[model samples]
Target: AAGTLIVGGGQAGFQVAASLREAGYADPVVLIGDEPGLPYQRPPLSKAYLAGKTDAEGLNLRPASYLAEHRIAHRPGTRAARIDRDARRLILADGESLPYDHLVLATGARNRDLPVPGADLAGVRQLRGLADADRLREAIGAAERVVVVGAGFIGLEFAAVAAAHGLAVTVIEAAARPMARAVSAETGAFFRAAHEGWGVRFAFSAGVTAIEGTDGRATGVRLAEGDVLPADLILVGIGVVPNAELAAEAGLAVADGVRVDAFLATEDPAISALGDCARFPSAFATGLGRDDTVRIESVQNAIDQGRCLAARLAGRPAPYGAVPWFWSDQGRHKLQIAGLAGPDDASVLRGSGDAFSVFRFRGGILRAVESVNRAADHMVARRLLAAGTPLTPEQAADPGLDLKALAT
Candidate 1:
């Protein structure tokens, strides 16, 4: 029963534990989490959960009884103080040591705090966990005006919800467009216009100097240009920082995150990392003549990495290479991206308006597809990318062509 010790009871951690059991690994499986409840899906925290469409119980990734049935020793409300590589022990905050033959780090990431004056005000909040969502839901119900600090997915999604609640909403982004770092310029413009159509105001290329407070609560936000926008509540969704200090302290190679090889294994043979915390060289990138590693913060990356690592640990060693995909729900639009797209990649638009898709090509080969409300195109892109099928921009832009047929 001396086997896998998984730190961080998140999607990746829970998947690894379940995958091990599914692979018939009859050993001790311990999953530790700093949160007080069962692992839950995080995407809903900003979307459905914040809108009161779903409750905390609905956010649970799996039923509470599932852990008991799988024989996974899930320690909730616990934190790992440090990892001893030589001793193969995980030291807990309460002074308990857990021995393991293999260790997996799914530590994930934390919400980056807004470091500015009045940031500690009562009405200012950041959404990352269940508790954060609960507090935000209560705040949104009573808020008259909501000011969002970033125009990323979380910010836009929450802004849509706030707007739906009949509250005045304004989103301030330091970047020139919404989701500038993640999506292409065309896709960013589409979402920006879509959000605007839904009664949301945007302040692009705008910097926040400070938050204005009154009676220990946020009253508004001060722009870099000395203009103050009034708001009753403020939400910060700038970005996230990987929780890789635990692995770095144990001498694991860490850059933007814990650097891993193609197999998702760290420098230590017995230790591996996955999910948002692992930065590994992507096979997809290597095919495109880039050897640099990437740290993806999507559920697809986490679940795929977990299953890949599980199979390898269970005597089915294979390099981890899965076509990454992501989706975000904002108001009436459902934006989906299949495969990875670099900043320099050329984009070709197909269709138009809300039902169109943007195909990204690097050196005449399709790299990624960003589809807005086009689920069929997204599904086709996933198959095409996974098969490594060469797609030309001309073929993608042609309305008469069948993308799904070409993929097969």
Candidate 2:
């Protein structure tokens, strides 16, 4: 088979194949994925799916017939062993091989393992894909005390779900505050207060030393301070490591991820990478006074990058320059972020109570906005950032100011 070969049938890979067909590119597109079943949306895996609000079928991006109709050759439950860059070939783990005119290494990222004792015990889980969510859903049903390691979006989202079940949920974080690396201190304080109000406990500046197991089942988590948090189920959401080993082993430059340019193209013109696996230059990063390259792990980034790459492959080239955005649904409240921001960015407050937006500025330039239960502000923020619209700190702080009008 020739045409484009997409290695990883996640959102990014599927988008590329779909977009190529939509763009009327007459080529035999093949998408090989390691996960069994139709390609599905992952964001819901930690929220609605885990909370029993949605099922596996609801998670799919499209129906099975859509792939066939689009002429996308879906190869599920297949693994790519390595790439023969010299020959433009992809070797499968099962000793099969396929050649491609263009290759997309959208292999995505994998959950970083908790390197501690008794981590592999039963009842200890981590949510990344459907299987993990299913196991966790079962484990959560019979668990009373639930301890979540890592205070990132995944952990907090899981905590919200567990706490909703009336379970005693405690979140342990190495950082001084939850989501410390992403949001401003003020925003973190707001969420911390909200979580505490939900009867959810938090252990800040903490580390997990080991997982305590009894009868080959996780019973608790031992902290570094020699304190054990008794639990029937433990969920580890520390972070993820980019699955760029396949690209690296095949002689592609990989730092934290597969190195790509603003066009989302690797050094070799024949190959490209995107999603969580490719670290490409981002305009938002430069505007936020940070490094140019950023590898985002949101559904927005994957879809945008896939569409951008598809345009390029369709003979209409344009640099990938979409504004970065993300969201987290914690119980009744929602947190939305638009654009990239650093720790040192200035924070300005707007709105009151649970409905507010934290505007981040760097060098007097609006960089990012963190909206809590303020969808209107989040929507306007994406436009403001994408268009590089001028918004002053004073203006952002003014509650009476019409942000929607300004953005328009």
Candidate 3:
């Protein structure tokens, strides 16, 4: 009650509690999570975990014994109902209240539901938690024809796994291309070709109107264009809606997400938010007629923000300014993105063949770099962007120029 009370036991929450202890903070750290198990990795749930390549134990951020040894109280399967900011307390759904010297809102985002008829069918599934992954894995085994409603990272990843299993996989996307909002056109086209080579089908600029079902189980997905795609299972990976209702109810600044300053601190000094739920100012933000604050949903952002907030809580205050980076493993190729790119950003190509990097520039300034199977370029891009080193489009286009040397 006298220490930190962390709500939402995701990666960010786990990191904050772990970092607080690592920083030698002798405060009583109690983490409250609605989930029924210890905090585990979420990214793998759509990839290796669903493929049965990794067990649930392998996904654990740490064993229960580690938490006990660290003296961090972890309350699993408990939901936080309200934030009593006036009393500096977090009210739980069970009518229990937790008082805290410092409050952390790490309530991560939830999977966006498919708003269509028959979406609640038994064969329709979403991958978010361990339980969801467990069900998906079992479903994939029995499913012959799989239809993914979105071509986002999670959907693509699941499609790759299904394709590998020799299942008929079709990815339907409302956008013109896969990952339209995230990656550049060149990168998206490359991945499109790659996924196609793996026997995966894609329906671009298509929307699901309804899921056709029989016997309370999904039979296929009907598109807006009056076409029905047959499927034994439907996987919806549209996106996520941030869990900012609690913060909003508590009278905290909330827009697309819980608004926080660069330090990840809300208007109230005692309250802070991070992970996928908090939108804070980013130096890497494109800010080209868009919100300067970004709510990134990657492991990098979660861990970095957690450490940043943890340091501030431990008396070493520094603004959260880590270079944003993200990755997705689809089939044999790996896509790694460094920095943040604007939609209208100009792209420059470097390297060739199946492996290359797309350097995106906004207003003649390097904003982001997307690397495909080129880990070297990704590392250099992050270093260059983080140090604010000026990388000209000409230098990026030049094959002879050594980015590693320049970064060094």
lDDT winner: 3
TM-score of 1: 0.97
lDDT (Cα atoms) of all candidates against the true structure:
0.91, 0.92, 0.93
Tell me how candidate 2 scores on lDDT. 0.92
Which ranges of candidate 1 are over 4 A from the true structure? Answer: 286-291
TM-scores across all candidates?
Answer: 0.97, 0.98, 0.98
lDDT of 1 by residue, 262-312 (tens): 999998999999999999998556444345578999999999999999998
In candidate 2, the residue pairs with backbone N, CA or C atoms under 3 Å apart (3 or more residues apart, or in different chains) clash, namely: none
* Ranking of predictions according to TM-score: 3, 2, 1
Return whichever of 2 and 3 wins on lDDT.
3
| Clashing residue pair totals per candidate (backbone < 3 A) | 0, 0, 0
Candidate 2 wrong stretches, greater than 4 Å: 287-290
Ranking, lDDT, top scorer first: 3, 2, 1
lDDT of 3 by residue, 176-225 (tens): 99998889999999989999999999999999999999999899999999
